[model samples]
Target: MRLKVIIPVVLISLSAGVLAFTKLGLSDDPPGRYEVIMNLVGQMLKEGHYQPKPIDDAFSKEAFNKYLRSLDVEKKFFLKSDIDRLAPLSTHIDDELKGAQLDCFRNINTIIKQRVAEASAIYPAILSQPFDFTKEESVVLDVDKVEFPADSVARYEAWRKMLKYRTLEKLTDLQETRDKSREDSVKNKTDQQLEAEARDKVKKVYDRYFERIKNRQDDNDRFSLYVNAITTTMDPHTDYFPPDEKRQFEEQMAGKFFGIGAGLKEEDGKIKVLSIITGSPSWKEGHLKVNDVIQKVAQGDKEAVDITGYPVEDAVKLIRGNKGTTVKLTVKSVDGTVKVISIVRDEIIQEETFAKSAVINGTHKIGYIYLPEFYSDFNDRNGARCAADVAKEVAKLKAEKVEGIILDLRFNGGGSLPEVVEMAGLFIPEGPVVQVRSRGGDAIVLRDRDKSVQYDGPLAIMVNEYSASASEILAAAMQDYKRAVIIGSQQTFGKGTVQRLFSLDDFYPVKDGQSLGALKLTQQKFYRANGGSTQLKGVSSDIVLPDPYYEVSERKDSDALAWDEIPKSNYEIWSNPVNTDNLKKNSEKRMANSAAFKLLNENLATLKKLEKQESYSLNLATYKAEQKVNTAALKRYDAVNDKVKELNITSMKVDLDKIGSDTTKIARNKDWLKARTKDIYLDEAVNVMNDLIAQTLPKMQRKQQ
Candidate 1:
């Protein structure tokens, strides 16, 4: 388990001298905008949400608890007395929302501001000197499981233990480095020197982190978080996006946005270009490379503004511009070379986000299609559609005459519902794919009117815990029809509800040029053609594989909607349904005998043990011994990626032609092919396709006889 560092508010400053608590403004009068938004939100939730719960005392309390948890999940800031003081507002939120009175929010926000100011003074005092790592005490990593402090003294004590634990970790890391160096040469630094250096490293990390928090957060940001807390209480997917956030959301959904298209991240107080999106201005110019530190930005031909110490978010504002606009970036390459690169911003379409297929050269030629999401262009009817792209991939694979096809939806979190319907129609004959039920309405069966089968060969849908929404719809449809062998996790992410994005401005007219946020409301819930809702209980796989990495499921979310059933739609099952029992038995027998799977199980057991051991000893020797044991256990699973049995993945001719003149595109495609060679999941998926081919071959022979 990774121990999370809790940065006290006093740690907001770099040095001890700057730890001053400022008084917060706590006005009882609510802002007029708050009243307007509150009334709008209340009306929207009642009319727009799929299943609107009454805005009663129970809902208010739930929202109140959720808001506090969102603000401080680790129980770090507020004291027990503070919570008791605000306890009355837990049930009063119901009345407040109805009356457009934000007294609760005002009170809570004011108290948090005061708490943050007070916390700014504790950390600098604590980190002024070295901590005793030899102290025979333990620190809990899962602080959420613990209770809040009773008073200010208790809170300070909690912060002390947290800082000490972090300092100990840094100390251990430095000591290990010093020990490793001692193996080759004589060590110069003593334990005290190493401890001091370790403390400095921890302090710098927290300093940078706090600096960003201070620089980015404002009253409006706090208000946005407060609004989101209320919206998300309805469901995890429901959210309130402010004006700027709404624009970002639209850009994400559009798949193409007007910008320089360089992915940026902050590292060591510098904004570094992580990657350049292919087909973007930065990629075409061929100057900005990954790991290049951006120092300054100039819009058009204006004087360059120094962005050296700017946060990644702030640095992005300088880089992004209107389409066809020129932006100059002064960057420092990894080799210590400084150069100014000019790039004209344009529409950057993420091709990799679309559908792509490859031929897996093995015992059985398998067509592998990896759809990252069910992307669809809502802005243009003729724009990119995942369903159409998938159909194209199927055609490309068919041209190669592959024996089997594997649709990988392992990490696909789903997108357009209509695209999923069309994609599902590609496998089986046209029929009802899924049923959607709106609030206070009957289930409407969404069917594929197209009767033409695209690729009717042996198919296997690869899914995991993250394969959700549209992914689940497709998987559930295929499973219902016995069209494909669903393999991977026990069940997919159980997100069955559909959300409609609504602009807040449309609901209430604002003449003051003030910006109102957008709301993502759950308007409908989808059910399988078999009548079973895929809400809390997602689509289960036929051959459940070991997923030791991510323990994600709908049940983990406390506010998830309950699973239920509607009337089963009248639909015909596939004429030749899959023999799932035989397939499951064979897969299970093979898994029980496989070395890789045995190691995977061992790794899962180790992880489970680590999850249970949340407390860590402050003693250096004890901590090192525990880490050593965990590291040794992890070594067994190191060969998991190396044991990839020949998956000869090759790009299609169309893709090869597209990448012919572009070196970056060629390199990216080559990397994609190389990555597939080491994919353990893909290896198993190919094996599953092989099993399906083998099973179908005997049946074909009998049919001939």
Candidate 2:
């Protein structure tokens, strides 16, 4: 894959009040494993990293601050006094690294252990007391806006407020549920009883939470986190993975996992769903979404288990199971409502994560190919490759005599750089597709040497904010050649840097059963053949469209590499360039007049306004009123999805053989085709192709003939 950005999912489960771990007593000396890894990491950064910063006191301070944040992101554990005590060693970390000592880490680890033990006592005491929800107060949920407590008394007071807020949140939820239903059972319960129940529920969640934190983490995990702090200081994309983390990273990149098929992360001390893998059982079930917090997990016919405090890895173990078994998740939505979702454990092969084609019935037959990622099986020569699969799909479309083609790359976060070059060649006469420049090396153009143009017809490439890396390269190349009209989001995700993974064991051999993990280091930057880099500034779309995801872009990422241009690569422009200026003007006019687009814009505006909110009330009245307003506003946008357009999408005949025997595949394909009819972006892409055929392609084809 070309610069595969690995997002590690950390989920762990705990048994009651205990977490499984091997704790090391604090010592002034660094552990043998840590000493070896740290020294090697420093060497690797200096030699292997493309943009290595000076390993001076400034870098040391950055790493120190980063490590502290990782240890306690929500400012709930360490107090201001603890921070003050640790402050003196901030610049000394550079000296420590150079001398192969870790006095600072040893002291910080000891302090954290004491604080965790103290926190274990503090949470239950606070939760056991009755919470007065009627109190007029607000808790600053934004961690960056708040400071650490001054001392033990102040820390407990902060804990009290946080615990009260949690209880208040649950109390409001319970009261609202009763108000909504007015059921016989719910109506019988007194407000006091309901309030007490909510408090108990919050306590149970925290009880398990504190227990897991006290137990699940080992010295290795802590050491790994410290190493990552150092690595990530180089850049946001660069990361150090512990052995287990490396295994998980490989599993995800392989496009399959024997689990519930949900990506997870620890956010604000809760396990939040990062994403539901496409074709996974959880995705098929459709109850989960990004940002939803998983509060509890239960096996089939077993008592529900609280997992709120569990480490992400431990929680993930509880979620993963033998195929066909059922795991139930109690998921809290983004808006605070909670529900139970059950998904059967299954092997997620990720077959659907590759390229898939369907024929869209329009005035002119149009073939639509959806590439989720530029995937490839590097180990197996005959294994699946996205470019090869796309070529096969195009050949199938050619056999069907399709008049035009649309490549849908929305939310495709890129993979396999070589595969992208091959895929780009399929649409145009082969030439320089992209330029790669490594540190201390000359810029080399990655070319598609073959002169064959496979699908040189009316074409449109659809993208969104999540389209990135290899996605940017392919789109930028096609745009540069004027071979196709790029449509959809304002710009694609601007990740143009390349990364190479190095196994830590390769540098230094470890003892049997011990692992040092892997490091993903940025090694190069990619530029378009026309000389423009798609780094921070992504490939701009020809026909811009309103998208809820417009807020997401590389510009928001503070650590992203800057945009710069290199010398233009030698390449010929397309013989028949597209009329993008005319096409864009027509699309803008249509978007202005279209009702669906209008509603989409309104929805995006509301979403963006909501995104600005940083504080929330602990008072039930104010919270509910605000939530109601947001809910009502969201309901107005439901029409955006309900409004269907003219799209007669059908599965390819070639896919029939693949889906004939598998009912799951058939059902998935059916759902996919149904969703396309309601997709405004796809609707616009099809229209763009129609416009191309009517206004642009005819003249170009005549000239070529």
Candidate 3:
């Protein structure tokens, strides 16, 4: 199944590097900022990257093609003629990196601008006319499955089919709503009127889509994309972060930001609210709600800017500013009422991204900890960190007298390396956590140093294909020590590389307050304590689950680094190990008898089958038939856990006391507890915890306690 899970791969990065760009830094002639950054990044990747690929003709060709795809991934903007026009300069990118003029990027950028303008007119004209639903045609949604349009006529046909498909989608949804709604106005509409309305809506959506593309995506944004295409050709994780993007990445790593606390998404060309953070400005203001369409954003008394077709990131930039500053939003509610709301932005702590604990009570009381990421804030000495937060959670769970503990690292993308080492030490005795190797340098083992074990009871870690970098390191360490039973997908996301951000200004200083962005370069590789790299081969689970994201992984990316091995670090296994064989057999038997799991396995197969069938029919009747079958199949397995019996779970008394009388926090905590009530994975994890308690208990207490 293609789940489309967007998660960070690996982020164990150092902020600074050795002064290796001395010659490139102090050149007499300081070039433009873009050229300076390009040369600086090239030198850093070549000299500082853990395993640098040769910057030669072959690499240039790949980077050239990658940049083209990045510009028009859908193959809609560029034609066969455009690719042919740019073909001659494809192998000259390396020359540009080696002090030549950047002709390739300049030419490609110019052509894309022209094509984007051309395609803008194409979509509106196509949507103006009525489509014949009687025409039976199929469109391949996957870009790799189709080639660029041969000429302008073919391009127009492509746009027609695409617009028709979009119109059909809206028409079907409108039909479904009319059939289900009780209101007389919607229920009485005829098919012909509905089709026209759908076409109009599609046209409006494309109008805004093109408007944003034509206006907001500037030359700098396109340049960043080109830089990323080059860096990612070296490895998927390495990237070029412009200043604002770098700040956003740091905020994500810290699990907080200064904003109105509303999560936004671009839907039908409108910026809509997805969620609101608890105890933040929007939550306190209480006007902004889910699905509210934000039309304009103003800074206090300043004139408002129309943000109707603004991308989510652009809207966010307009909304968020210095703390205590007022940002006004003009919102359109779902009921069609429009109102202007003003809110003073503040520090929004995303507690949802932090470590939280819940007690799962069945035959035994088990503590569950969900760590969204390996978050850390090095900038603030007193800032919240995952290691300290998880330690606090563990202490609370201990006070609750839970029998066993389960650590869920399912979607943790990873953060600071040192923090993960300390977090891993909380489980096992002082030992090696992970190994790191620089370019042509000996492997260095990062050790915990502490001899104390915080939790010696039965332990288990939950992982999936999205458990990457630091998550893999922790899981691999615990598994190597035989401390925790790894359970979830077949293996975790295999991102075993370390990266560091190098500020371009450090390498090439420019005058007049010019700011050059930073490069997040891959500087090292990660290995488990057992010496096997986690690069392409991630840590395997002791008990595998029927995961729906089987196809989403690092291995799928052609540019991912290769897996290798190093000498095993000196360490000792846990003196007491969990009997994984018994746990595996027990889990297998439980799954074998589960009807939910049976349905899940069947649904997975169906999803796999549907995922392979990429082409979709545009004819109304045929499309409806296909969607009806597919939708029903998915509906049967969607939220499968909701069908299972709810497991008894609750928050600790200390947590309740800490959250006392804060209505929003209290309600959010309750919702958090309620969400996991019927989680199939957690349900079985609770069962495994019960079995472990039974297996480890003393002879007398086995039956009594």
| 1 or 3, greater by TM-score | 3
Per TM-score, the best of the predicted structures is: 3
In candidate 1, which residue pairs get closer than 3 Å at backbone N, Cα or C atoms, i.e. clash? 9-120, 10-119, 10-120, 10-121
lDDT of each: 0.80, 0.80, 0.85
Clashes of 3: 1
- Report per-prediction Cα RMSD to one decimal: 9.4, 9.3, 5.4
Tens-digit per-residue lDDT, 1-705, candidate 3: 011112222223334344354423444564667777777677667766778899998999999999988888888889999999899899887777666778898999999999999999898888777888888798888888989999989988888888899999999999999999999999999998899999999999888888898667788989999889899999998899887777677778888788899989998789999888767899899999999999999999999999878889989878977789999999999999999999998998777889999888778889999999998876687998999999999998998899899999988888888889999989888889999988777888899999998888888899999999999999999999888899998989999998776666665555676667778888888799999998888999998888888877899999999999999998998877777899999999989999888888889899999989988999999999999999998997885775678988888888899898987788888898888898888788788878878887763355466
TM-score of decoy 1: 0.89
Q: List ranges where model 1 is wrong by over 4 Å.
A: 1-31, 182-186, 277-279, 283-292, 295-344, 510-514, 644-646, 700-705
Error of 3 at 34 (Å): 1.0
| TM agreement with the true structure for every prediction | 0.89, 0.82, 0.91
The global Cα lDDT (0 to 1) of model 1 is: 0.80
